[model samples]
Target chain A: MIDFAFFLEIIPVLLAGLPLTLLLTTASMVIGFFLALLLALAQQGNRRIVIWPIRAFVAVFRGTPLLVQIFLIYYGLGQFRPSLQAIGIWWLFREPYWCAIVALSLNEAAYGSEILRGAIKAVPRGLTEAATASGMSKLLTLRLIVLPLALRNAIPNYTNEIILMVKGTSLASIITLMEITGIAQGLISQTYRAVEVFVAAGAIYLALNFAIISALNALETRLTPYRVRA
Target chain B: MTNIMHILGFQQGGWGAALLAASSVTLALSVLGFILGAALGATAAAGRLSPRRVPAWLAHVYGTVFRGVPDLLTIYLLYYGGSIALTQIGTLFGSDGFVGLPTFATGVLAIGIISGAYQGEVYRGAYQAVDRGQFEACKALGLSRYQSLRLVIVPQLMRHALPGLGNVWQLVLKDSALISVIGLVELMRQAQIGAGSTREPFIFYVAAAALYFVIAVVTASVFRFSEARAWRGMVHA
Candidate 1:
């Protein structure tokens, strides 16, 4: 059982880091969404030569642990300081924050690309045919017709992915970015009260997830305002 | 050339073999964890499905607590607090002091507990997916609970459960990587060692990532094949 008084002490301290946690989560999801869009579009069977490699890239990113990716990006790239200095990009690599963002964005992009691909494939063929029949070019048809339908079809699943990404942002704490989990870990180390600190952190995460869930549920209802009566 | 040779060569110094062995450790841990999770998951699923309030509440609390927290935090709590708890219990029995948990067992248990929460949900869904008519018919045929579960229910549930279990296996495999933070000599830890010694984290981390990718893809393919075989005669809606 958790002591509520101990939790009352820790909750405020952990909430101080909520801004950074939310920032990383939203920033990565937005950036990753765009990258995934471009990749999904580029890999939709036009460029066979590029398809295999892009598929391989997605596979590798999705397959490996995100923690390894973060460690590799931070420490692994730090080993290339001389080269980075020559290119004047050393400053970005020096900060753990930037590295965490890059790694999170890349990992989410790979997973998001798959989600987008599945949604795109599920688009009704006749809609695209109708768009094409109206003298629309491939690009225009994709932009106006396919993407909207795919996105609407994908909202439910995509919302779940967003929530997952929010949870995954906790891993960035390992590389010394003081997100919620990191702060909680620090508190536990100082106070030697693992249960209390962790309980507070878990409550914070559950609250955040609950908010996301309810928000998405409302969005789903509003998006499909017309419901069929059984 | 000498530098490359030194890095590659093994004389109680090189990391090539250590990293490979660590990868094997990761695989072994995941296999054990998955099995343990399956057992726990079944128990939890049964609890959730039971009419008794205590069992249902137990299952609910287990699923909610594990799913709500970050898996990394859970692992950290276990790594730090598990030994202390065990030693306390040992002291109660007049045993020796400080009963340390081995890294592998700790890692396995942490992963098992985390994955069990997910597996419970999957199993509950799969159980519910079984045709209601089948259950009614089993009862009408005078089958005992165990007999019905074994002959009429479990087979169908397993079929529905396989795809979900595949996803859980993947999750367990990736989560096993998180155990490296506790100084487990797993792939990520081995990569850290090689990185520190050789000052070439980029190469070794990339290599580790490659190995993980290979394992994930291979396991995914095997799961896909099994799912296909299991669903061969059935029509999917």
Candidate 2:
């Protein structure tokens, strides 16, 4: 009673959700990268006032689950429509797409910042001193020496985070976005073939992650030529 | 004020008790899932390390596929496929019926499957961290493979693996929230019920987040304590 034909049929329907999934992953990751840089930079500062709040923010975001954050943004904030409308920013929260992107980007930013911080901290202090001795300004030294090394160190972990974001977007289905998991759920109820439909959906995710992982692997190899065997 | 009192009350029309009870259930689900995952993980670690080809390949496939796929889909698959598999198994035993598993069992099954993939990597890495010279010493001492593993390998492997396991534990706790979609009355599901009933999604969701945070912090303290114990009597441990 196993149906290969049904598996074949659901592939196209699930792929329909792929664009939104990719869009959400790409958009949130891009936004998340900038926010994370801000966060990482903020935490690197000396001011206690600046440090404590950002520390708390990162801890709160990281400590809780992404599902909770999504619900808070979507349903919880949806409860405060009048207040938001009065504040003139209700339009952003009005759409589920925007809500998911906001929640996901926030969550990704928290983790991405941690990764960025670790990679930056791992850079050798002597390298910076040498660059300074060579008469480079702090900004030029940071651009030429520090970030490139940190980014190279960060590629693998950031790639892992992106894969995680791809998986995380599936939760957007709970809030009524018709992404892969969402469409898969619809098909399961309609077709009564849960196993096959989910298999197809899972395969789609696996393929997406594989493509991303391979691309990152190529980039990692390019960045760290010495680490590779000839 | 009355509505807040009613919501916070332990008596009739209140959800404080329900939410707290569900939090305990959430803890139980995570522990059970983690234990089940540890068992599967141990088997997978052995399989991957085995000299045989098939078990190694099978374990590799299991780890990759489970880790690569989204966990929510795994839960959904188990929820639906479990009953189907159970029903068919029951029919061969002359019972024509729906052998439905409780939601908690299904949730554990999903978490176990997902966490097993991760824990296998942790165990394999820990095993590799054990000095190769130590294993040769055991062989030179004429110790049986089982005795060497029990005496020399397992303890150090566990010590090395403690931090990684701590991470997997946190992952399990958060992943348990995903089980709520299957109608399990865990913290997230309880919050959903309250939010839906009260139309105050903010309070319930925030309350849920708080509870999750408290549990995570407390559990982390326990892990830290255990790690400290595991590292005792070392030069820099």
Instruction: Say which candidate scores most in TM-score.
Output: 2
Each model's C-alpha lDDT? Answer: 0.87, 0.90
Highest DockQ model number: 2
Write one digit per residue (lDDT tens) for candidate 1, span A29-72: 99999999888888887778978888988988888999999988
Measured with C-alpha atoms, the lDDT of residue A117 in candidate 2 is 90
Candidate 1 scores an fnat of: 0.67
Which number leads on lDDT?
2
The alpha-carbon deviation from the true structure for residue A161 of candidate 1, after best TM-score superposition, in angstroms, is 1.3
Lowest-lDDT window of 10 residues in candidate 1 chain B?
A: B3-12
Worst 10-residue lDDT window for candidate 2 chain B reads: B228-237
What's the CA error at residue B179 for candidate 2, in Å?
0.1
Residue range B145-202, candidate 2, lDDT tens digits: 9999999889878879999999999889989999998889999999999999899888
Question: What is the TM-score (0 to 1) of chain A in model 1?
Answer: 0.94
